[model samples]
Target: MQEEFISVWVRDPRIQKEDFWHAYMDYEICLHTNSLAFNKKSSCVRRRYSEFVWLRQKLHDNALLLAHIPELPPKNPFFSLNNARQITARMEGLRFFLEEIVRCPVLLSDSCLHLFLQSQLSVKKIEACAEGRSRYTVAEAIQSSGCRVQRFCSEEHSQEEGETDSE
Candidate 1:
């Protein structure tokens, strides 16, 4: 049998709530694995950033035999939090972190990261988000494909214009 691989990425993070205690942000994760145990499953899940950190901290205690796991993007005040730019960058960083873990044979097999990738959001977390009672932040990473498609069409039009102008 061909070797199976795992892939994971984060996307579409938005500010779910900005209130005290109940404040939260949410994002989507896409995971694919072809392992026989996992049966080549692919799934997407919604999550809050805090849940991600909780998973990261849990991994730290068990990563002694593995290479350095990538860091989770910080929720620091260095840049404005809950903004499109910050949220996108954080999601991008998380995407990188997961990609790194997947690339490593040992780290990729780690149960903690796999659980984080494939597990559903806990009931408590879902209820907490529902109770936050705040509006969703409109900003999220505009997917790269949509922008690339638009740019490609515009470039082709400009090229056609250039050809006519030269003639």
Candidate 2:
């Protein structure tokens, strides 16, 4: 797999209220392909930029909620217990978010073509073999096929080479 450049931006703002506290964290994940423009005719570049913006907004809302919101876990009787629980929950949320984000690139990119013809032999060599070629030329052609096919060809050729060696 080719290398991918990943950039992450995180912002955390803590707001303390008399009864509770709220913290908002935002994250932006980007991929760089070293192209000035993805496609001149299409809006793929603009769309990617927009996705980053939307992700930041969504994370801010989910992470930095209102202090009084009932959706958050209730405070524990023991301060240490409450703090520990909150920290644990935050870590879990971050782990889940990162796992989800990591999958996006692989799923979004184009990997289908490589999957289809990965085992194919080159067309030119096959044509050359069909013509009147020397034995050595044909043997080299077979050796340069896909890795699995090449292995089989080499093993067969070794048997022939061994017989010649003995004579």
Candidate 3:
């Protein structure tokens, strides 16, 4: 059996303006993995807090009988991007959420999770993509659906380099 390895980072928070009065903090979710469970080796998607809520609810609904769902960062109506502490707290919270979910094989297998991490699809479209109604697979969706697919050195190679530097 091949060892499965996956890592996720929630970073690069930026406020997105939908209009003058409507704006929200958006995060860039970056993923790297060697697991075939994921369609891509590396990908990034920008998502807002609402999207994280949707994902948590969906995963909870799906796994209610099977596993414990992790809590998301508390929703703060007064979230200010200008506040460094608030930004750091939210980013760390979001990152912790992904790290916990990826550690669970049951949660890791959800198509919604795949789409959330790798594709730039809306909640509705992510459901559609998972259901085979969409034309693109998660890999193809990342390539064509505005998500960013990044290329990084393999984890093994990076680890070896770190060891050499320490020697």
Top model by lDDT, which number? 3
Query: Over all chains combined, what TM-score does candidate 3 have?
Result: 0.83
lDDT of 2 at 143: 34
lDDT of 1: 0.57
Better-scoring candidate (TM-score), 1 or 3: 3
Candidate 1 lDDT, 85-129, residue by residue in tens: 887788887777677767776665555455456545363432233
Indicate the residue-level lDDT of 53 in model 3. Answer: 95
Instruction: Give the per-residue lDDT of model 2 (tens digit) for 3-83.
Output: 332221121223223355633332221122222222111110111122333333433443343211112222334423235
Residues 65-101, model 3: lDDT tens digits: 6877899999987888788899999988998888889
TM-score per candidate, chains pooled: 0.60, 0.22, 0.83
Off by over 4 Å in 2: 7-13, 16-82, 106-167
lDDT of 2 at 39: 16
Please give the RMSD of candidate 1 to the true structure. 12.5
Of 1 and 2, which scores higher on lDDT?
Answer: 1
